[model samples]
Target chain A: MSSVDRSQRSNSTLKTLNRVFVYTILIVSSLMMLIPFAWSVITSLKSNENVFTHSAFWLQFPPDFSAYKEIWNRIPLLKYTANTLKVAVIVTFGQLFTSSLAGFAFAKMKFPGRDKLFVIYLATMMVPGVVLLIPNFVIMRTIGAIDTHWALILSAVGSVYGTFLMRQFFLSFPSELEDAAKLDGCNPFMFYWHVLLPNAKPILTTQGLMAFQFIWNDFQWPLIVLNSESKRTLQLGLSYLMSEYYTDWTLLMAASVLTLLPIIILFFIAQKNFIQSFKLSGLKG
Target chain B: MKKNRERSPRVSLLAKNKIREALWGYLFISPNFLIVLIFTILPVFFSSYMSMTDWNILSKPNFIGLENYQHILQDEVARETFFNTFYFSVLSVPVSLILSLLFAVFLNQKIKGIAFFRTAYYIPCISASVAVSLMFMWLLANNGLINQMLTSFGLGPVKWLTDPKIALNSVIGITIWKGLGVNIVIFLAALQDIPPELVEAASIDGANRVQQFFKVTLPLLSPVIFFVTITGVINSFQSFDLVYNMTKGGPGHATTLIGYYIWKQAFDYLHMGYGAALANLVFFAIFILTIIQWILRKRWVYSEE
Candidate 1:
């Protein structure tokens, strides 16, 4: 009994030491990951002289909003933001509608070749977006939709991943609800509209948030498709700022901060759902 | 005869419902099917055909029959880009997997303030790539924060992006930093999925902590490890926006990964057919790698019986 007590004391001490070590590493790495972003915020608030002379960690005596003002005046910041909003909102709603409809069909509906078609859809996820970039661009150009939001919206509306996600959620749903609805003489559409969708609020929110994040942050596709100054998305606008004011770190940082604001806000608002969805999707993969 | 008569009418009614259900399924899936077919499916076939042509996106695509593929093979820039892409993935994927796993393991500990650390770590992942890139561009500048810290430690300032020799590695570091959160979260979930009884049993059998981790926990975590590695490889191979925004494959083509290369060819140079061929090659490479990993998964992944 004495030996066991001694051993337990030693083990507890060892665990405490281990926890200390782990916490140290975690704290340091977290700092490393966050310092750049913190630095951007600081630099954005610094005067040009302070930005170059003082260390990034140094706080400017008088914070400057001139950089933000400069960026606002120099570019159509609000317009670009509105453009991004339009694309993200459209894509989110579009993907939710399409993915849920197809997801329900693939999940609950019985039809010939259903499984085969679902497999094909799953296979499409493996094809890298880069492969489709040129052909899609060509198609869009052929149809004269280049330099338009239509290109961004139309191309991104169909999401195999989102459909797959919704289908998985739907598959786990209990069938008794549907059976009861059917017994009440409700058709499939009515059952879906009144029963399934209402029950799927959590998943719908998750998918909507994810779709918004994706479409809002997307750069390459929009960069290729939309070129007009007035049609520039937030990301494109930020990139444009980067090139035009390559040396103006203050302005660039300001632009960066503004660009990330919405995503960060969204993340804070839906932190649990975002993290949960990521875990779910990662596990599914 | 009486039972057969009783079931016959019900079977006919069921068949009718089945037919109607099938039609409804078709109707429900039509929107997705049409979009995917027009944007994804048709583009895939069209690109494959384009790969064999000499189209410049202006004139009609004249059939060239494998010339673009041959050009890709002979082109030095394409070769360099492919090499850079392979180098980035090979270096980044393993590092990302290990770091994220380590993070997950440590973060899984029941410690005070763990939530704060988790959120801080994940903040980078939530930020837009362009924003992250711009932030890094500042931090990596010659007299930037990172360089300032290095100098304070008596180390010389390393040209993070300008020096071609280390540019790709720098980009890889940033990518890894930004990507660590999602992988850690996945790993945390996987770690949680591991049954506590196995570890307790191992400890009861006199296994040390390290021994328990190796003998029990690691085996249980192999499926997630395999998954993270496969997805890591695939995603790293498609690295584009970071390189594009940061270096534009600059300093004499040092950081030009295949995705960026394809973009430059198709968009910048307007060699649509050639770009299509390169894109196809990338697709084939990813497909082959995925297939190989799927085949090999049986050998290494711990089967959850």
Candidate 2:
């Protein structure tokens, strides 16, 4: 009995030690992940002279907004932001419509070749986006939409992953609800519009957030398609700034901060939805 | 006879409704189906056909069977880009898996401020890649914070993005940092799914923490590990945005990942046919890797159901 007491004391001490170690490592690594963004914000507010001279962790005594002011005039910041917003909004809504419509068809309807078509859609998810880049570019050019936002919006409308996600959400939905709705004289389109869609709000929000992120951050495709300065997306604009203002760290950091702000804000507002979507999609593997 | 005659009309009406339901299904799916066919399916075939032709976006494609493939095989730049891509994948994927698993294990512990820490880690995953890369580009400058800290420890400054020898590794570090959040979240979810009773039993049977992790927890987490590994490789192979933003495949051809190489060939250099060929090769490479992983999964992944 005395030995047992001694052993229990030792075990508790060991557990305490383990907790200390784990918390230390977690705090340090989290700092490593977050310090860059903090640093960007600090650097963005610093004067050009202080940007390189000040210690990275140091803030200038009087924070400067000159770089922010300079970036607006140097580049068409508002125009680019508007363009990005336009593309992202259109793409998000387009993907939601297409994905949810097809998702409902796959989940609740029994059309001929439905299963085979779903398998094909799944296969398309594995096809590298690069494989379609050149041909799509050619096709866009042939159709005379080469420098237009139509290319961005149209290409992003059909998303296999979004459809897969919505389908999974629909599959988990109870069929009895559909039966009751049908008994109440609901037609197919009415069932989708009034019953199914209202119940699918959570998954729709998740898909909307994801689609927004994808379109907002997308660089390569927009870079290939949009040739004119007026048509450039926010990312393309940032890349141009990087090349032109390679030495202007303050202005560049300011622009980067401004570019990332909306997404970060959106993320904070919908944090749970984002994490939940990841959990759901991650488990599908 | 009267009841049978009454049921016949009802049965025919049900069949008619079934046909209408199927038609509605077709109508609902048509918009997505048509777009996918026009954009995805047609481009796949067009891309394959373009791979065999010589075209420069200005002229009609001229069929030159096998020539583009032979050129790719013989090309030194192509070989270098392939090596760079393979090197990045090999370094990034396993390291990401291990580090993320470690972080997930740490975060999984019952502790205060866990949610805050998790959010901190995941914030980068949602930020724009262009912005993140630009931020890293600043942090990696010779006189930047990283170098400042190094020199404070009596070590000389190291060029992060310029020197070809270490440029790829620098990008790899950034990529790994950006990717840690998603892997941690996935691993955390998988870790939560493990029954607490299993670990309790393991500890009760005289297994220490390390032994419990290896014997009990590891096997249970194999499915997620497999998922992370396969997706990691695929995403690494498709890494273009960072390379484009940070190095521009640069300081030489050191960080020229295959994705960037294909872009450069098709868009920058106007070698559409050759780029199409390289893209096809990338598709095949990923397809084969996925196949190999699926085959290998049966060996290690614990079947829960």
Candidate 3:
């Protein structure tokens, strides 16, 4: 009995030690993860004199707001930001509308060739975005959309991933809701607009937030499509800030901070939903 | 007019409703179908044909058949890019998989301040890849923070980006760093899906912590592990953004992975045909890998009884 009691006491100590170890690891790793961003933020706030040094983030009690003002004045940052906002908003709403409607169709409606078509859509997603670059460029050029936001907006408006996400959500929905809507003499579009869409807030939020994140952060497609100075997105603007002409580290960092501002705000505002959707999508995958 | 296109059978209410539902379904999916057909579907065929031509984005693509394919075989730069891509994926995917799984296991503990840790980690993932790359560009510079920290420790400053030998590896490190949070969350979600009773059962059966983790926990996490692996492979292979922003495949083309190479070939040098061919090759390789993984999943993934 004494031996068992001693072992149990030792086990409790071991568990406590394990808990401490876990906390230590988590703290260290989170710090490591945050340092780059923190450094960027610090660099953005620092003066140009000692911007590259270790003391830049520390010695300065209050950081200078000069770089933030300079980045905006030097570059058409507000314009670039407006461009990015326009595209991201349009693309997000566009994807949400198109994908949700199609998702409802795929999930709730019985149509000929439904399964086959959805399967084809799934298969097409495996085609790497890189493979589409040359051909899409040619297509965009052919349609006279080069150096325009239309190139970015048009190609991105249709997304199979969003559709797949919404389809998965709608598949789990009960058919009884649809039957009740139909009993009230609702047409298909009315049922979709009134009953289905009202209940689809959760899925729509998930898809919209994801779409916004994706479009806002997208760099490659914008790089390929847009070239005119006035039409540059925040990503291109940031890249321009980092270009050979401008080696202003603080300026670029400032641009990055501004670029990250909206997303960071969005993440905080929608943090719960964002994390929840991520977990759900992870499970779905 | 639309009704005339389809045979209107004025039969039972159910049949008519089915027809109406089908028509509505068709209408609902039309916008998506058109876009998919134009942007996604058409490109596959257009690019495949473009791969056989010598299109310079100027004149009409002159059909040159398998010549582009032949050139890609002999092209030393293409070979290097392919090798770099393979090297990046081979290193990055496994390291990330293991690290994410380990952290995820530790994080699965119901500790106070777990949400804060999760948010902190996810902050990197939320930022634009370009932004992350830009931050790291300075961070990994010779006189940057990392080397500064190293110098304080009495170690020599290593060139993180410029050196040919270490540039791709540095990019790989950055890739893993930015991606670790999302992967951890994924694994965390998967870990949470496991029943506590299973772990309890393992513990009661005289299994230690490590044993419980390996025996009971791992099998359940296999599906997510595989999912991460496939995505990791795909992302690493097509990892253009970081390289584009950080190194621009510089230092003697050392960091030029296939995606960057394809872009340079098609857009920069106007070797659209060769670019298309290289893109196809990547697609084919990824396609094969995905199929192989799908087939092999049954071997280890725990299917429900």
Candidate 4:
């Protein structure tokens, strides 16, 4: 009896030891994970003198905003933010519209050669964006969208992944909802607009957020498309932070903080959805 | 007799409505399909044609069958970039998967403020990669904060960027950092979805935590792992933003990834056809890898047919 008791006690101790180890690792790793972003924010608030300090983390509280104020003339930060916001918002709504229409048709209605067409769309999903880069450039130039936001917008306004996701979502719906609409003598467009769309708020938001985040953070396509300073997105503009004249670490960090703010807020507001969307994507396998 | 007489018109009316529904389906699908056909589908075929030519931005493409493809055979930088990307996927993808898996296992516990911890864990992923890469570029430079701290601690200052091997590794580390949170979140959601009673049943059968993780949980988690790996490899192939923003494929072409190399060829060197050929190579490589993974999926991935 005593031996059993002792063994039980030792097992409890081992469990406690494991708990401590887990928390310690979690805390340390998380702190390390956050340090770079935290430092970006801190460094942005630092004066030029403190920013160049030899210490890895020089703390400066009650920050000066001179760099933030000076960053306007330093770069076209406002114009870039506007461009990103405009593109992101338009792409998000546009994708939501285009994807839902196709999704509804694919999920609820039968058509000629539906499955074959979707397979073709899925086949192209594996093609790397770079493979299309040269041709898309020529196409864009030929279409007179080379230096315009239309190059970013019209192309990004629809995606095969978005359509596929929305289709999967629409397929999950109960048939009674559509049957009811049909019984009510609702036409296909009316049923799509009223019955189907109202039920798709969750997926619509997920798709919207995904589209917004993707467009907001994208750099490569915009870099290839936009030439003039006035037309550049935030990322493309920030790439010039290390200009030939001088490199302003403060301005760059400050701009990063600015660019990251909206995404951070969206995460806070709808983090559960963000997480759920990721899980939904993982379930694609 | 009168009711039976009415049924024929109703049947014809229903058949007429079926045609209308099919018409609506086609109408709804057209805009979406057209965009994809124009931008994605057509470009792929166009890319094939472009890859067969020799062209600069100045002149029209001169059709030179297979010359660009042949040039890729001897391109030293191309081979190096290919290896660089391969090592990148080999090193970083598995590490991210494992670390995220571990985090998911550990953090699956019931604890207070776990939600906040999860949020904090996922913040890095949502920020722009260019922004994050730029931040890391500054931090990992030779005279950067990290080296400064190393010197202050009396340790040798590692050349994080200058040395080609270390430069690539440093980018790998940062990429892992930026993406780790995302995988962790996905893994966390997946872990939560697993029925807890399965783990309990394994424990009841005398399996310990580690044993149960290996025996019970791993199989259930295989599908998510498969998805992560496929996506990771796909993203790894397009690994340009980090290399471009951080290292610019620097120090004697050490960091030049395939995407960066392709971009440089077309935009910087005006070798549009050569770039298209390189892109074609990537397209075929990914297509083949995807097919192989799909074929192998049924072997290991649970609940997948």
Best candidate (score: TM-score): 2
Which of candidates 1 and 4 reaches a greater DockQ?
1
lDDT string for model 4 (B1-305, tens) is 99989998999998888888889999999888888988999999999999999988899889999999999999989999899889989999999999888888889987656776677678888888888986786677555678778888998878887797688888888888888877887788778888989999999999998999999999888877877988888888888888888778987888888989999999889899999999999998888888877777767555521
Q: Residue B55 error for model 4, in Å? A: 2.3
TM-score of chain B of each: 0.93, 0.95, 0.92, 0.92
Worst 10 residues of 1 chain A by lDDT: A276-285
Model 3 C-alpha lDDT per residue in residues B223-289, reported as the tens digit of each score: 7788889889988778899988888898999999999999999989998998999999988988887
> Candidate 2: where are CA atoms >4 Å away?
A53-58, A283-285, B1-5, B295-305
Listed in order, the DockQ scores are 0.72, 0.71, 0.68, 0.69
Relative to the true structure, candidate 2 reaches a TM of: 0.96
Question: For residues A1-285, could you state the per-residue lDDT of candidate 2 as single tens digits?
Answer: 999999999999999999999989998999999999998888888899987676766778788999999998989999999999999999899899988999999998987899999998887777778898999998889889899999998888988888888888889889998899889999878988998899999999998998898899999999999999999999999999999999688999999999999988998999998887667657443
lDDT tens digits, residue span A130-182, model 4: 78889999899889998899999988887888898888888889999888988
Between candidates 1 and 2, name the one with more favorable lDDT: 2
**Per-residue lDDT tens digits of candidate 1, residues B77-126?**
99999889889888988999999999898888787888888888788887
Positional deviation of A207 in candidate 2, in angstroms?
Answer: 0.8
lDDT of 1 at B79: 91
Residue B145 in model 2: shift from native, Å?
A: 1.0
- What's the distance in Å from true for residue B92, model 4? 0.7
| Alpha-carbon DockQ of candidate 2 | 0.71
User: Which candidate would rank higher by DockQ, 1 or 3?
Assistant: 1
What shift in Å separates residue B75 of candidate 4 from its native position after superposition?
A: 0.6
